[model samples]
Target: MISGNRSKAWRIISWVIASVLILPIFIMLGSGLSATTELFSHLWDTVLPTYVLNTLSLALIVAILSSLFGVTCAALITQTNIKAKNTLRWLLMLPLAMPAYLVAYLYTDLFDYAGPVQRFLRTTFNWNSPNDYWFFDIRTLFGAGVVISLVLFPYIYMLTRTAFEQQDQNLHRASRLLGLTTFQSFYKVGLPLARPAIVIAISLVLMETLADFATVQYFAVNTLTTAVYDTWLGYGDLSTANALASLLMLMVFLVVLFEQKARMNQRHQSNRPITSSHEIILTLPQQILASVFCWSLVILGFLLPLGLLVLMAIEYASLEQIDELVSTGFNSIELAVYTATIATIIALVLVLYKRLHKDKLKALPINVSGFGYAIPGTVLAMAMLATFGPLDNYINDLAANVGIEEPGLILSGTIFAIVFAFVVRFSAIANGTISGGVEQISASIDLAPPSLGVGRLKGILTVHIPLLKSSIFIAWLLVFVEAMKELPAVLLLRPFNFDTLSTQIYQLISDERLEQGAIGAILIVAFGLIPIIWLNRNEDKA
Candidate 1:
């Protein structure tokens, strides 16, 4: 009877936690869906159509470009005998650690007409003005897509490469035996098998493209994310902003559905373990082309931007900048610590409930909690404000009635909002990591704990906690790193006079003076690298 009551209590608590996490989103969506027709018409007549077009166009372009880059790179690394395959494989993933907006700012500074590259061209060609030669502008929509794809293609590359690596070697051998060339075998067998992974990857890229704000904003490309930002802060139109956010949220939900479907189909694909490695040997000329392509991606995507930041830091390092970095870095770290702790704890509770409880809807809480990962930061920020803003007002009113000093916007106007947003945005990471860890424990151990007269909570505390220590630490670290690098949500929800490394660097980029914030940018990139390096090391070990 005690165990039944405890299970019931846990089930209720898990559902409550899930509901609370998702409550803001539902509230925001409700406000938008029920918004006045006048506001909807106003948006539609003015900039809404343009924002929608730009958002879709950017998503489409980035999807295509990322697919091309990722698929080609994965194919070369997995299907062909690419020189330095091991080195190139990990290096390709490093670009993901470099944020798209930072790359955009750095590359623009390099290739703009007044920058060194153009100046060098003019000096060498003896050209004076615009009539000398046409130059490609890095600030255009297409350029934004390319910049985003540079960092995001790694998602595709990693997943597709794994799919290719795990494909049944027998299929490839049969294709080759049927008089097919290496390329034909790859196209006929390998590509089709990896299609589900490619689709899932592209869906992820599309969701990310839709979520991007700083890159599009810096490039003066008005997408839904920027539109939502401008509507909320720039124009103070909360209702309209909520409406726009809801629209963007709807789009993301579609992509999530598509990705889920692809993931389901993915299970039908061949997962036959590799018995032997069969690599297509490249001709000398082919080797040269492949090497150049892979190396160029690495150089352009990660090495160049990182090198520029390093040079900027060396040239512009100062005590004043360091002081500011330390201050903002503390803010970022504090926020990340809070978010990581809360998210990990919540993930632990929900995942454990799902695992140990006998409830019919055991998985519902975990599933609901993870929905926030699909949400863009901008939308999540809007959701936070929409839900917490009114709640804060009520709290203040109650405090005043009780003759207490009214806490001014404690929830909505303080770090609480930012931390909540981060937790909501990143709980999925913790859930996934913890769930993976939980899955590794033996089922017999679950019975053993109960058979040994250990209560559920005590058993988990003593046994499962020790076993999952590494996963818990990793989950905390991943959330911490993501919170540090997150810009859009923090930018929207941060209290006045508060800043993080990402926000500080964004400010400098906006002012066209990122040199002053190069250290902060470097710090953000370094934090972003923690998970990538950890993942790569684990994969290598595996």
Candidate 2:
């Protein structure tokens, strides 16, 4: 009876936590319907069709490109005896450190009509102005999608490479004996078995693309996420913004449903132990080509922008602006550390709570919490406002009722609001990484502890956590990098006069002070790159 009661209490706590986790989404949906019906009509007439087509087209293109690049790189590094394969593997993932908006901004600075590339051409060939040549605009949809894919491919590459390393070698030998070429063997034998890894990576990229507000906006792309911002801030139409956001939610919903369906068809059995019988020794030409491919991605995604920033930092070395930048750097670092730590703690609790009870009630909350990672930051900020505006009033009402009212807590306009929004937005990263780790640990461990008469909490701490130490570290690092690069949510939600590196960069770029913005942008990327390097070192162990 005591054991049953303990389980029951834990179960109730899980449901309560789950409800709080999902409250933002439900609040957004509720507020959306209560807004104007004309907003819905406007969506159907003007923006909905274009938003749907653009978002879908971008997603499909990014998915294909990222998968090809990621899977091929993983195969080359893991299966083939390529020169510098170990170094190349980590270099491939370095692009994750470069934020999409920063990439777009730098490319624009490098290649735009008024920029150095065109200026050099004009001075060299005795050409005049903009009309002398037709330059490719980096502001187009195709360009934006390409830029996004370049940085985002690392997600697929890292996960799929690990999957390839862990794959069962017998499957490959069996396929080869049955008559398959090297490439064909990869598709038939390797790809199918790595489905789980591919699915997770692709889903993450899709969600990131959908959630991106800065990159799309900078490029003037009319994605649903961008529309969410334009409608709310540009037109001051909250109802229309919410309506557009609801449609965006539906798109996310469909994607989630498709994933569930696909997962249902998976064959979960004992994986054959992975081993390799044959390895390819690449020719010199092939080696050069691989080197170029790897370096090009690193340069385009990370190095060039960083170089520009270093130059700008030198240019601005004399001013107090450098000191100000350093101060803002502190704010950004502190916020990122706090956000990552809190998010990891919450994700651990949610994942463990769901795992221990094995009840639908607890599972629902964990799943709901995960949804926040998918929502666009702009939409999330707006949802926070809508939800909290009335909430603050209610708090004040209670304060008045208690006869101790001075001024109600202004949570929305304070640091508390920014941190809370960050947690809500980024909890998914921690949850996903930690949950993936939990799944890898054998369920038998949990049953073992109970059978041995250990307390449930003690079992998790002693057995489950020790096993997940590496994954927990990786998860925290991933969350830290993401939080550092985050801009849209921080921009919309931060308190007055409170600035981070992201906010500073965005402000400078928006004011057309490209040189100044490049400095802060570079700092953000540098911080992000630290984790990429760390993860690469840890990848073999993982």
Candidate 3:
């Protein structure tokens, strides 16, 4: 495949791009590991411990609760004769589109003491004092956990549901022959098979929980993500912030390790046909309970918050808000376009290199470049500053030496930085999508292209690109939506007076006035639903 000069150049270009993508991460780690002794001592003496403890606690609680929600819902939908099972399956996944932070803000409005719920209760009981009743504090760490679980549990539900569906029916049959009740047979034979997938899914939940910033920050529940953001933007200490980011990365590293270990330990493959499986028959009461549980998850996770946003938007909508949404919506769309295009191009380059390059070792660039998906935006923001800050200085010095005006923060404080960060963070989505499409194309097609006198780039444009058009579109759509909803990195990296939909919503949230941005919030939510709709369609086809 690497028979000519052009192929060799492609391989070189692929490696260079991969290096650039990972360069920020390496710089962040260097900054963290090379921190001043005083900074280390001060951090170790204060704040760091609290951040670590909060992060660990939040991750554990979210993971456990999300697992419970995911497992129970998966079992009910796939293994029982539950009411509305078909609708419940897709409804459960809608929450994944609702960003946890948005849910947090909306729920806080609904459940806050001054919100309608409390006002109604107070009027109903004719009691106006705090002692009149008790309400759960929606701003507490536990509250943050539950809000996160609502959005994140679907990760576990989707994966575990697939795992449950793929289990060998003969195992269930054997258990039934042993006189086990339907429920008992599933409990003993089914769950054990799904355990590894469940563990891996929970690990994904924990990783996302650890990476969360806007949700915990709004709730005043400080985790490592919020800490890193605060340390940089609040304290104006880049080194300390990078150190915290490094620490967060360590936690994520452990999660990745755990996921890998679970994957390696997986032993649940079965030869049985998935369609041959039996769904357990639920009693009337059990069916009712199951229906209520699944429906509640959908309501709280996606529908209720969405309805509230729509109401707020309707009640408070104005020409000014519409104008602002237009401006920020354009910003968001422009940013997502730039990010998706560049990341997709990078993904295509690297993936094609792996497939066509003679040296198998060239494939390493794909993994290296895609690593940023595992990184939190807050961490990536710190890394970007750590990397680009120095580069900006060098560029300024060079410009001054050449008798030209210094361009302050040309790379670090411009839209370029924001686009670069988005590409780094979301390239994995593009890579995975493109790789799937590329894998589906038979090797014989590559030979056909060459037999037709098509060279490397020509072959890609004529044969591969045509075949991959759908995948490229899907990849672009995924990255675009993710870039639109991404908050922390843009919150840090956006230039003065710049606001995308997410950053604008976060601003209103921080000011305790999400209603002002309700239109913007709903717009973001609507964009998030595009991917979910696509997934539902694909699942139906499957």
Candidate 4:
């Protein structure tokens, strides 16, 4: 690698950009710390304990359920001779595209007393009054846990399945020679090997369960996410909201740190010798049971909710609704475009610099940007307001002192804050995608360029960009999809009277009018599929 004035320029620019992106978090921390103890005392006396307990319980319950469902399904598919596993393999991942909040709404409507299940139960049982029979309520914390777990179990399933598939068969042969049975081998040998993957997957589930807002909010569970929204938007108390956001960020950061540490120390090196895997031949009873169990999750998590949404759309579709949906769709796409483009550009620059630059601190920019991914969107939105509100005030004061017109809320009162917050939250996606692509590019390309007297900048422009075209497109599409579905961040950061598809759908959810916005919800779910499908296709090609 060659270093010169050009390298120095990029080094400075990289640090500046990374620092600017991370500045909001520091501002939020300052705001939270500046709050008087009176605010803390009030929150502690009223709702803080409830928020923490609900959040912890939700994460714990979801993690346990997801692990159980995912490990069983993965074992059925990978460790046993199950029927229709090829179909099951891809079907298992379909739930990833379904949002948890949508699942909550659909299932609530399906299982409530006013819904078909309960009504049918009451009618069939000849129950005239409430004491006649027992029925489960779908609006409680337990219900929220079940709905979120259904869609999230796929993370564990996918990772554990891959680990099970790739486990060295030699280990199983030794276990069998030592008189261990099939189930015994799985428990003693295979399960231990897949533990790291399972831990990582569970950590992901915990992070997502913590990030969820609409689902818990709809159920009135009072997690930190809803607390932030209620404190700021409902009560107009920014200081307490910032403090709660800071605590949430702290929790997410701890999870991220654990995952990173475990990942670094993981012992499953791919360099190990490959061996064929053994699939257990199942009896008829086992086969039937496994098939029923796996498909039940698929149907409940994806097919049922999706089918319900479609039915609602068909029954309620109208021109007036379509017109409003189109307008909201445009707003979502516009926000996605802005956020994706900026995030992708920053990711590309930072990733390329790390790969090409000859500096000990080349990793700093990427390390900084990746931290944002673990943060929940509501926290990020609070961070944005905390940072930009003061910046806007400073600019307005300066303008007045200089006898120029005051620019009120130019930064905080517009879509700029929303887009910027989204970029900060999602920049890690683009960074990871492009970084993987950059690694695939041969080092010889850079070596050959300098020998031909090509400057580094020209070589990057002419050579690197061309090679990274596919990755750039993929990164941009992922960020776009994420921004479109993002709820809490846009809901908090969007200007007055401005609505994206997410915020509008949330409004419909708040008012119990989801049927009217079913078409838009479908659109959001459909948009979410692009990145997942694309990632699968890329994985297939590789």
Q: Name the candidate that leads on lDDT.
A: 1
Flag clash pairs in model 3. Answer: none
Q: After superposing candidate 4, which stretches have Cα over 4 Å from the reference?
A: 2-6, 269-272
Q: What is the number of residue pairs that collide in model 3?
A: 0
lDDT, candidate 3, 1-542, per-residue tens = 42342466777898899999999999999998876768767877987788789889999889989998999999998888898888888999999888898999888888898889889999999987989788779898889999999999999999999998888788889889999988898899889888899999998898789889999998998888988888787878898889889999999989988998999988745654544677788888888888888999999999999999999999999999999899999999999999999999999998888887776687799999988988898999888899998999999999999999999999999989889999999999999999999999998877776777767678889888999999999999999999999988899999998999998898898898898899889888888899989999999999
* Superposition TM-score, candidate 3 onto the true structure: 0.97
lDDT of each: 0.91, 0.78, 0.89, 0.88
Provide the clashing-pair count of each candidate structure. Answer: 0, 1, 0, 0
- List all candidate RMSDs to the true structure: 1.6, 3.4, 1.6, 1.5
Report the C-alpha lDDT of model 2 over 419-507, residue by residue, as the tens digit: 77778878888988999998897766668776777777777789888998987887788778777878877877787788999888877
Better of 1 and 3 by lDDT: 1
Error of 3 at 79 (Å): 0.7
Off by more than 4 A, model 1: 1-6, 268-272
Candidate with more favorable, higher lDDT: 1 or 4: 1
Q: 361, model 2: CA deviation in Å?
A: 4.8
Poorly placed runs, candidate 2 (over 4 Å) = 1-9, 268-270, 355-362, 397-409, 433-476
